[model samples]
Target chain A: MSGDHHGSSAISERVRHVEALLEARGLVDEGEIDRRIDEFLAGGSPANGARITARAWVDPGFRDRLLADANAAIREVGLSMAGGLQEQRLKVVANTEDEHNVVVCTLCSCYPIALLGPSPAWYKSEAYRSRVVRDPRGVLEEFGLELPAATRISVWDASAESRYLVVSRRPEGTDGMSEEELAGLVTRKGLIGTAAV
Target chain B: MPDRFAPGDAVRTSTADPTWHTRLPRYARGAVGRVVELAGHHPLADDRARGLPGTTQAVYHVRFAAADLFGDGDHAVTVELWEDYLEPADPSGGTP
Candidate 1:
């Protein structure tokens, strides 16, 4: 979303260099990469995660299944993550009245790209990764989420094999809202446990 | 595969270095935590990244208190770690 493409050309050029190297070795197809990029651009976004969270909020049975077997449960909603090499298995951690959960990747930005679309720049930034691990509440404060003093927080550090999703507690006074409307209230920050839905 | 630790068992992450590809974060080295759940056996990404074949290990969800890792916080951070990355947190032996 940076308006200055020129400022990012260095990073883009590095990516192109890697792509060229792989193509030269016949390890990857340029056409396939383009197609996958197109699909990701079209289908990947925080909206997919918001949809899953909304479904879980309304259907207790689905919530149970989602928490028990996230990969299988997502398929029921017509969503199957791309799995092969470098696949990420998802784990859903719920928030309750006494506890809240947040997700991070301290080593690197190992996130669920297929389900959550792409990770935010802040999520991948060194400042977020290093600070969130040491001071989660302070980091959340920067995101404008001030939890109750007594509410326990748990942070999930995602890895290459397993990614985490924080299921924010559904907001009150919207019990009668439709699923679509509820999904609209869910944001990427909420899924990451930095804000409320 | 035999499970070295079960759910709710207290365990400590090893400080050993695989000297290869690893998913274990530096922040979690030599940390004490509890096993929350079994993530089943899978090919270790550390081994897989090297183009090696047929090596696998059990993964577990381990919970470490925020205060334990960073020395000041009111939270916990749960991480999924490979089996070889953990050891029993013996009470007699000093832990980091």
Candidate 2:
């Protein structure tokens, strides 16, 4: 049900109408919208997030900086959330032995698109948006992620301008792994906190 | 406007459900939570959504216990909220 196409044509139709209106008013030139979309999409991917997470796993100082000030720290890795006119605020939360963090936007599909690429289809689904906030543990279980009963879960709802990223705990036995090797272990779900790295 | 609340302050979200657009989600309305961090000033999203010149307001990361929000849970939930959406929590007012 992730990419459920129900009512999508209606949305696309409405969007086309608005785009046509804008174009006719000279507000946007022909092909400008598609070009901008392509440009933005080209700049984003899960690799950017994985690279940042791998650096943090190996560097304590970098991890501290990233958790303290994500926007500035991401620049150190040559990644940015400044894809739009106003840069969305980024806050990186780390999972710990006793705590598990998950990110969700209950209102809409607000996400760190520049850092983690486009959101997964499930992320924007009504089931996720409604249930994650109410039953995060259940939702995680559905995602095949099960934490200890004692491990406290903190669900970060992106209801404002700030977007969140979860820095899952570095896996054990990976101390000898190189940064690139560690990065290879990261997935979009891990960054989104729906799975452990 | 000047920041009305700081990190660690207890606040309750306004329960008012405006017919127009608002960033204050219905699930959070009237709930009490403690401010975790001051996320700096951002334009009031509700006003911005209405095509008006929005005023900047302090946004905070507020933490709410999951048990309190959803009846029974051992976890917690955090939401970034604007200053206009919150008020100082009344110590005597029982949880919503």
On TM-score, the leading prediction is: 2
Worst 10 residues of 2 chain A by lDDT: A1-10
Q: Put down candidate 1 lDDT per residue, A65-137, tens digits, no spaces.
A: 9999898888988776664354457788888899989998877787777667778888887788878878888
Candidate 2, A13-116: lDDT as tens digits: 98899999999999999989999888878878888899999999999999999999999999999988888878888999999999999998888788888888
Q: After superposition, how far is residue A68 of candidate 2 from its true place, in Å?
A: 0.8
For model 1, the stretches where C-alpha displacement exceeds 4 angstroms are A1-11, A40-42, A83-87, B17-19, B91-96
Question: How do the candidates score on chain B by TM-score?
Answer: 0.86, 0.90
Per-model C-alpha lDDT, please? Answer: 0.81, 0.88
RMSD of each: 3.5, 2.2
Clash pairs for candidate 1? none
lDDT of 2 by residue, B2-74 (tens): 6898778889999899987888878888888899998879889888989989999899999998766777888
- What are the DockQ scores of the candidates, in order? 0.74, 0.87
Q: DockQ winner among the candidates?
A: 2
Least accurate 10 contiguous residues by lDDT in model 1 chain A:
A1-10
